[model samples]
Target: MTKLMKAVVVPAVKAAWEVRQRPVPEPGPGEVLVRVHACGICGTDLWMAHGVLSFREFPLLMGHEGVGEVVALGAGVTERKIGDRVGLPMMQKRCGACGFCREEHPDSFVTAGNCAGPTLTGVNVDGALAEYAVAGVGGTVLLPNGISYEDAAPTVCAGYTTWAGIRRADARPGARVAVVGLGGIGHFAIQFARAAGYHVIAVTRPGKHELARELGAADVVTDGAVLKEIGGADVVLHTSSSHAAAIDAMTGLRPWGKLVLMGLSEDEMILPALSLTTHSHQIIGSAHNGLEYLAEALDIVARGQVRPMIELFPLERADEAYRKVADGEVRFKAVITL
Candidate 1:
């Protein structure tokens, strides 16, 4: 008998989300079957649902940041075993023959943003918005023992992205680091930078001041000009989706400072040529740099050095959770508990 499991399914672009029964997917070669315990809803998932990012097909199962347990293994799989805890990331598979993959450093594939052939879970393929999902063995990361499924879900993407941005900045100890945007990613950036022994400053709207402080930000500013008024930052992590905000935040960079961009903006970012050239400023774009970074993010959370603020919803209330996330009503990240 084919086993059936509950799944959140989008019938078409801009269609109403449905919680329907789907057959438990079997792991293929080099794949493992995961019984999803928690899945984090991301802005990218919203984009795909709203057709902002046109997927090749509809009726999609969308969720990239998912943590669960391995229940079954497919042929030729030795690295993972049943009952092992794991998390599935967005970058599920990469073409090893591509130039980006051939780079000397694994992080280069992320910096280049072009992996010739890539299989993005929850984007181009079926994802973990279901009771059970399948993932390639190479794409799954072992979840540390201390962190819960809900907390570890966001770490795979949100936490990983911001941590990668911080690593890309490569700030010195005691250096001032300003994080622009107080959303899911920005919030994580503040904690990660603070844990790394940097002076963390948060740049966000007036509403998030208290939360920012609670998250270990030394100072919270409304914008880049305010950030500049105080001592400028040696590294600026841009995690907002507004290109204008990124351009504004550049003014807060100290001489020879690094500005790392982790946000996805539809608008083209325009920088002042004179300012950039004269200051010798370096602008970097970062994403999930490597699986090692994901592991590190999880480790920090497991050690209690960082915590991800999240709102939880049962799988049955998946639609309500989606609505809250789309309307920006959730305080921070939203996780669907199974």
Candidate 2:
């Protein structure tokens, strides 16, 4: 017999969310059924709801950052079992046949390299806004025993994305990392860089210095003055959604330094030719987490090296939660709890 569950559904772009009863999804081969405890409200959710990013399927279920306990397992799934806590991040599933999934060594990083096809949970298909959600076994990670569902929810996407940027920068001990923007992603970036032994320099609009410092940032600066004080930074994790802010961050990077853009923007950045050619600076764009990266993030949270700050909203108040995130009123991240 098919089981039914209540889920938040959007009939169309710019439509009001409605609570609808949908048939509980059964796990297919290589997948697992998760009884969702919490799901996060992200900027991407807003973009999808507002029709900014065109993955435009109507009557959609949206939520990529989800944490839950496994309730059932599909055939051939030996990695996890019922009652295990798991996380479903945005990069939900990848084809093992792709170059990104095939590597010569296990230590090599997994990334969405040049491959065009991948299954995204919220954007491409149904996601975790429901009482039950499905995730690929390979893409799911077991949450740390110490982290609660509310804290673990945002880490699936918001936390992993920033951690990926910091890992790409390869910041060494004492190297300076200037984190631009102090939103959800930036908050985690600051802590992850610090945990990686980098001296974090947080940059945000004028009033966010204290908040940045509270997140374990070694120093806080409102603008590019951080460049002048330290002579330059070894790496810059640019998480600001503004195009101008993303481009300006390049000025703070020392010669051969890395600038990782973790923000979503549609604007074009006009870079000076001499600036790139002379300094040998690198600009890297990142999204979605690899299996190893997600596991590493969970481990970091487990060890108390970093923690995500989140506001909880009841599942039925998903609309209010989305509005709060859209209005920039959420302190850090917002989670829909069951």
Candidate 3:
């Protein structure tokens, strides 16, 4: 008999979701079947649900940050066993033949002709909101025994994204790093920046000062004025959705500083002419980290170097979790447990 599992499915654009049965997927070659323990809801999922992002199609299963146990393996899968805990990241298997992968370069995260392209899991395919999901074996990371599924789920996406930004900035110890926005990615940026030996300055709205400080920020400022008061930052991790806020964050960067943009904004970001030419400032956008980088991210979390604050909701309450995330009322991140 064919097995089935419950899943949260988006039937149409801006429509109500249905908790229905979906077939238990079998792993293909170079893939593995995972019994999902928890899946974190992301801002991209919210955008996909509401039809904001143009890449999404109707009748989609939305979730990317998944933590589970490998229950079955497909042909040629030797690295994973049936009971190992692993993370189902948004990135899939990488084609080993690509020049980017052949060089073992960290920055060559190719989406096309590799592992399911850049969309990867949850964007255009079946995702981990279900009880069981199939993922390419290459991108999944085995979790340490000390880390729980709930804790590891958010790090797969939120933590990795922020860590990628920090890596792109190439910050050194004692460098001043400013984190703009106090959402999920922002919180992780603050912690990762601090763990990397940089002084973390959190720039957020007025109400988030205490929470920012609690997350290892050396200083908390409400606006750009205070950022100017403390000289300037060597790097700025911009995770806010507002274009104006992102534009304002550039002023905080010192000469030759990097501003890494991790958030998705609909408005066009207009930059001043002299900012880049005179100061040699860089505006880099980072997304979709590769599996090699994700493994490093997991190591940091497994070692207790950083922690992801999350609120749990059962699979049946997935709608409520989506609503909470969309409303921007969530304290940090929200995870759905099976």
- What are the C-alpha RMSDs, in order, of all predicted structures? 1.8, 2.5, 2.5
Most lDDT-accurate candidate: 1
Task: Please write out the lDDT profile of model 3 over residues 1-338, one tens digit for every residue.
Answer: 24999999989877676789999999999889999999999888888889887455689997889999999999999999999999987766555565555655443244532433343678767899999989888757898768889989999889888898888788777999999999889988899999889999999987999999999999998766678788779888888887678668777778898888998788888886688779998888787556666777788888898999899999998888888888887869999999
Winner on TM-score (1 vs 2): 1
Question: Alpha carbon lDDT of residue 336, candidate 2?
Answer: 94
Which 10-residue window in model 1 sums to the lowest lDDT? 104-113
Q: Please list the C-alpha lDDT of all candidates, in the order they appear.
A: 0.89, 0.82, 0.83
| Predicted candidate 1 versus true structure: per-residue lDDT over 188-257, tens digit per residue | 9999999999999999999889999999999999887888999889999988888888789888888999
Measured with C-alpha atoms, the lDDT of residue 164 in candidate 3 is 80
Clashes of each: 0, 0, 0
Q: Point out where model 3 deviates above 4 Å.
A: 54-56, 94-119
Measured by TM-score, how close is model 1 to the native structure? 0.96
Cα TM-score per model: 0.96, 0.92, 0.92
Which whole-number lDDT from 0 to 100 does residue 166 have in model 1?
89
Those runs of model 2 whose alpha carbons end farther than 4 Å from true positions after fitting are 95-117
